[model samples]
Target chain A: MADHQQKSDKTVHRHEALQKKLALKEERKHHNVSFIMMILLTLVAFYAISSDKIGDSFAVMFILVLAVVQVFFQLYIWMHLSHKGHEFPIWGMASGILIAAITVASLMGMIWTS
Target chain B: MSTHASHKKRTGLMDWLTTVDHKKIGILYLLSGGFFFLIGGLEAILMRIQLIKPENDFVSAEMFNQLLTMHGTTMIFLAAMPIIFAFMNAIVPLQIGARDVAFPYVNAVGFWLFFFGGVLLNMSWFLGGAPDAGWTAYAPLSTVSAGHGVDFYVLGLQIAGAGTLAGGINFLVTIINMRAPGMTFMRMPLFTWASFVTSGLILFAFPALTVGFFLLMFERVFGAHFFNADMGGNVLIWEHIFWIFGHPEVYILILPAFGIISEIVSTFSKKRLFGYSAMVFATVLIGFLGFMVWVHHMFTVGLGAVANSIFAVATMAIAIPTGVKIFNWIFTMWGGQIRFTAPMLFAVGFIPTFVMGGVTGVMLSVPAADYQYHDSYFVVAHFHYVIVGGLVLGLFAGLYYWYPRMFNRVLNDTLGKWNFWLFFIGFHLTFFPQHWLGLMGMPRRVFTYMSGQQLDTSNFVSTIGALLMGAGTIVLFINIIISASKKNIASADPWDGRTLEWAMPVPTPEYNFAQTPLVRGLDALYVEKTAGNGKMTPAEPVGEIHMPNGSILPFIMSVGMFISGFGFIYANWYAAGGGLGIVLITMFLRSVIDDHGYHIHKEEVEADIKGGRA
Candidate 1:
């Protein structure tokens, strides 16, 4: 009877251990932090565009830089791009950005030239 | 469960209509693409006949315009791209040691959409005239053109382009997620690597085309003024968007061809690809540079010197990576045993033919020279050299290489060689003189020319060459029919193949590998062979194989889109609404239905292993 009781206790402990492993506490914490940061970044972008203190050119540049940062945060943190098993996806996204940048930049150049 | 019996009951037409199997879908792509290819070839022959003698009076000017436009559209969008997709579907999963693509149902939907879209486009010929503004369909011409021709072009391409986008995403996810254990990115076959890059190009580049087509549709159908200069629209925007997609589209067609050549050359040479890492880097680099060079096509459009030069330099920059690939192919064969099989013959021929195309491409990139070459036979020759010599030859090579794997028979080598020599010589004969013709001052897209203008001899030669090419195609058809009737079963590893695909049984089992292979290195099968094992180590124990259930929704959805496409083209609102309703209702059914799929039990798998010679 004592041995049976001990086995039951061990089984319950293993179940709890498995749940803990599956829970992803650290990842959840990271997500929460990243969410707050994203919100803060959005507010800053709005302020940078609206504020009279900043000049026009600087405001444009600042907002653009901030927007890029927000995108990185959204992709790498919130979307779990920084996690394991995401290397190929990261490569895909990076190449996509590179193409998009080149396309837009050349279009701008063409517009300027024309 | 009795699911196996139910599956067996689904034989005949219903089986194909609802199949989610990659192999069947691949065959569908091949058949449809081949049909379009023949149509496109007929158009080419008719155009050649019209040009056989100056002022031949064979076809009218209007007819000639329609023929050229339809030929280019059908060949690029319908024929070449679908055929590429066919090979991709047939080989990539097997190459990567996966049972199916990441989304098998989506794959089916893509094929059906492409098929229906092609049908919608071709139906324009009977309903009215075909699109007459050339395949590029540049505005203000396209936007200002009369009739429902451009409308068909817009709607058909929109549906087909969406299908292509879905296919691209499917491949991207499949390659990223479905590789066998220990198959690293570096370990992937060259063809898969090329496919990966091509998918990236498709994902990024196709959206531009989609947006461009939508604007054209709205402008033409609803008078939206997106390209109507009379209502505050810039025509150059259309140019920008189209070439942005167009330049990359060419790469998307050619990159897989490059990959095929690499595979064939390496296999036939009995050597590993020299400078494999460099080849991968070059592919990515070329894909990257492809976007920047779009303006090269627009240099003669008055984009100005600075813009032209920038695009010119970017265009030339692509040649560096392409050159890297060319050298790597040559070096791969440098001191290795070379087999002269039909595929290898095409591969060997591709080197010089593609180089000629590439050289002319560079020459045309020069802004000053382009003024002379643009809209001339030189430009025509250049692209044919690339598209036909590079892409078409690559398709032929890939077909020969993988025919044994797909069907359980080898194509007759003697017939294959005849197909190769005749097509190769005919290709050169047809296009080679056109370069001189362009230099001699003959413009492209003309219905007729004055006799004794130095264009007669060349045009005559080109027509004869086209007939030769036609003969070659007939020979190929006869070969396929003869081979099919013979039912000469092939061994699994035909050609002493180097990749994991050859490890599977001939007439590859529906589940692909019975046990997911544990890939240990690049050319996994080659590695095992060298280690004296002659077979892959099984990655998992024998177990039940879970397979997705086939559904007819994809076909029905495509048919709905097809009906709507026609309705939109003809401006029939009620029909459009009905078609869209069907599509939405089908989509809803797909969402709510719970299809858990079925599994092949371990006992069945064991029986298969015992009964089949894998």
Candidate 2:
């Protein structure tokens, strides 16, 4: 929306903008470890093979567990929940997930018994 | 030039169409929401007329369903939420002494989406039928629901729900990030605190609704087996999800009203809210507990005794917090120099009326007892009391409280008193006897009672009460127009209000504050008035103010969804495809063609501060 005016008030702003740019760059560098871990986790999720072709509900359970863990990582790292800049959104999202889990789980339990 | 502006700084219809100013967007919300509220109110009157006599034939069964659906959906979503939000957007930032909300552009997007979505939902009337499933849109019936009515319900809500969610996020960010310096969270006005919690509830609650809508959409449109009995999908899941959102949604609408009433009572009584901390705690607790107890809506769904018992307890738990709030408001006025200003009268009226609703709610919480009450006129009476007495009364109070700030004129007090009494008496009369009818075994949502059902007399009386209520609503609209045209030109602080918004001039500056007002204490502006500084201290020195230029893109974005909404509704493959194309293309254009927003230079800002007018 601000493309109308061009010149003036550039000197002080330029210095401030440059410092912000550098800080962003350094912050990106600090996040490289988490980025690699997320990729490695995704590869494991896709490649892991289940043993014993018959009735191994255990493997399905294990894979679903891994998928659940991977979802948390995606929420934190990929979805930027781990990033300090998004703390407010992170907590809000966590509250939503908690409530949703409770509703779905309790309903599922009711359906199972009935 | 367009109707609202001349060759103004931001000229052209395109300006407002695309604009991001929170105040302008607030006006749009009011305009759109107000129209739907009228339609909803009209629907209510029509339903009343149909029930006026024994075996009345005024409307067909299908039409009755449509009217009821539109009435509930429009009032709750289009009318009530947006109306309150209109005041919040128009006044909250100004109240907190901030120049603008944190995400001004997204704010515009939110309003446009809501506007367009609302329009699309109503379009169902023209598209053969409006959604006839109750506004709750439960499954089985909705799945078997003939025609494109259910499609409109699913897709229209999906679009509108997106808009509401976006607006929620924007408000949350704004309240968290944009408070003026020295305005600590605790020191914030109760209205701001209420808005903050309402926004938080919106953030969590609305998404569950969106998810439910999608599941419904996929089930209906793509033949997904999400709710199909033969496919092992449980229809009950839909009820659970809807109530999950529906229950919290009541709080989302009411909490703001609670905040407004608190402000009104304290200001009129010449005191602070007597138990401010308790009120705040209660507000937060309501917001939290709103999530835990969606099942209370479904006691008759045969959640066995164990499940029912647990939920019954949880439902009753809401009463503790609610009671604390009611007590606080009453105490706030006790022994004080009570001024029965129009707004204060409404606040005082609210206590007993809402207490009635709360008592019924607690009664409904008794799981065994609810079996008799559920799906009856009793439940109907219960909600109407809460909604009309609590929410509508609070909204009317706010309209009076902030009329001067909104339009630089005071509503006629005599007319306002008449409006209040007519509405109060009419509302109670309309819904009160519903308890008796329910106890007599009258099920709710039935188009008509059989001629010999023994239900005729009560229904007739209810219809008469409805007429009175309808008459009362008319008096309100008349008061508004007459006041707008002929009422006194109110000065700043028209009600001797104790909030930051009152510190601004009557016709506020286009730039809200020249320098943001400094906050030294709670009730920042009132503190200044009492300690005898005639006006607020400026928190910041004057400088350039960055105001987002209104653009037509938001309008286009909303129109895209509107088109897509019809596409989904009619099951027009080509229309659906084309509509998605338009919507996605607009979004892409918005991203790729970035316009670094316009700014009000230091000189312009100073000039605005000098001449405080829109």
Candidate 3:
């Protein structure tokens, strides 16, 4: 009877240890998610009041801002761009975006002027 | 490696016609794209002939406009982009050590969509007229364009655009999910980097085009006034949206060329790319900045000076990154054992020509200055300088570089030199005089000019140049056919290259690798070679390989849209309504269908590998 009681105590202790580890991970995740959401919400609120062209300008801005956040989310979570093992594609894709931006902006400027 | 039992499972033209192999799919892309390139070239030649002399009357004014429109659209969308994609599709998955692209069936579908769309667009010629709407198919004019011309533009691009978007998604997924063990992101080749970025641009940019095309359809066919000025609708909005898509469209076209150039330059020069990280950073910066500057295209349309000035500066900002890239290329060639192969010559030539293009681009960015340059031969000159000097040159360079790998035969150097010089001299001859004409106040798109307008001589020169360019293009075809027929197989490492692609065999196998390669570093093959390891270490054991089967469903899906296209154009209520119904039904069927695909048995695979039929 005493040995059986000892085994039960050990099992309980192991379960507690696992629970603590899981709790710590969840806490970190929550903190990060809230931080991102809060920043995004704050920006949207500020931009909503700041712009005169609220419907079009701020709306576009908001969409773009949202897209930026989404890209970050995609890179980190969906694309795993931040995954430790995936340096080449991450870097390559990033460069591609950079060059693409220049091409669009330059042409836009030229065409707008022309 | 030909000892495998399944090594000789099938061999025939039928097998190739029905094959779902990524390599084969890539070859199909090449053949189809090549065919279109020829057609576009012919269009270019016709355009040149029309402009040979002032009041030449070689072709009708209306015909000239359509020719110009189709020429631009076909070359950029159907010819260049798809041909580049052919290479990317053939090589990228292999470079990354994957068995196939993320979605093989979609890959096949994408190619077919392009093929059919190009055909559909061409069929407009037989129907009545071709799309006279400029490649951009700008709003007011496009909506007002009579006949079925605009209809072809809208429907053809939409169909093809869907295919292109699918291709982008597939590449993105493949790169994301399929890298082999130790093949980290930084280790991928610059070309793959380009494909990834190009795909991303396609993803975002195409949707804007989709929106634009639909609005155009509404106005032209359905009697909507989205772009009709009299109906409280703004035509400029269409311009905004079109350029929004259109401006980035150049990047979509050129950045991949830059990627190819980087690979070729480094390989032939026998050195690592100078400023590799910086080059990467610049590419990304360019892509990000692409969306910010579409307003520049609208300066002459009167967006006010403040908007114009900001756009000018934004436009100029692009040059800094471009200049950096140019410097990087120059330095890449510096202090290296540069082999002046046909590809290398093109790369070297690109530096000066592209830089000149860049300078002019910056000059055009100035709103006040563009007032002088806009709608003139100068504008044509600047764009031709960029597109021809930058993208087309890079493509030629890449073709020469990868020719051996693609066809297993080195393009004859003597013929290549002829091709390059004729193209080079002819290009300069054709465009140089245009700058002078623009300076002399010649407006573009004018079908004819009166004598003593002082434009005749330069125009004549321009026509002569165009003819030379045509002759050069013909020579390129000749070189391709002769070399292809010779069938001298490319070595595994044809250029003594740095990237992973050179590590693989010529005529790469269906499975890509019998086993996925375990990459240790950048230029992983080089590392293996130096280590006296003759073969790449396989990351995993050979086993049954899961692959998607070839299907007729994608073709059917496209045909549904192709048929519905007429409905939208004819504006027959039944056709539009029922035609759309067909599309909806196809989608529904596609979703409901269960496609588990197929798998090659391990025994067959082993036999193939042993026989080297893999």
Residue ranges of candidate 3 with Cα displaced over 4 Å: A1-17, A20-114, B1-19, B573-589, B612-614
True-contact fraction per candidate equals 0.82, 0.45, 0.00
Ranking of models by lDDT: 1, 2, 3
Candidate 2 lDDT over residue span A1-114, tens digit each: 253333345656898899999988875764686677767766665555533553456656667887787787667655767656887776677787787788778888777678
Show where candidate 2 strays beyond 4 Å.
Answer: A1-49, A53-56, A60-87, B1-8, B11-15, B451-454, B608-614
The C-alpha TM-scores of every prediction are 0.94, 0.91, 0.85
| Candidate 1 chain B least-lDDT 10 residues | B1-10
What is candidate 1's CA lDDT for residue B51?
92
Residue-wise lDDT of candidate 1 within B1-614, one digit each (tens)? Answer: 44544444367999999999998898889999999999999999999999999888888998899999999999999999999999999999999999999999999999999999999999989987999999999999999888898899999999998899999999999998999998999999999999998998999999999999999999987779987778888899999999999999999999999999999999999999999999999998888888888888888899778888888988988899999999999999999999999899999999999999999999999999999998899999999999999999999999889989887889988999999988999999999999999988899989899987888899999988888888888888988899999957988988988998899887899999999999999889999999999999999998889898899999999999999998888889987888888899889999998787788888999898898833
lDDT per residue as tens, model 3, B1-614? 21223233446765554455678888888888888888998898888787777778888989988898999899988998798788888778877888889988788778877877788788888888999977878778888888998898888888888888889889988988898899887887778888887887888788888988888877777789987778888777788788778877888888888888888888788878899877887787676667667777777888778778887888889887777888998898899998988988888888898888888888888999889998898989998898988888888888888877677788878888888899899899989899889988988877777788888888888888888888877888898888768746767676787766666666676677777789988777877877889668888888887666555566666676777777776777776677667768867876897766666788987898788655
Q: Candidate 1: misplaced stretches above 4 Å? A: A1-73, A112-114, B1-9
| Superposition error at B440 for model 1 (Å) | 1.5
Q: Could you give me the TM-score of model 1 versus the true structure?
A: 0.94
Candidate 3 lDDT tens digits, A8-40: 999999999999999778766855885687577
Native-referenced Cα lDDT, model 2: 0.83
DockQ of each candidate, alpha-carbon based: 0.65, 0.41, 0.09
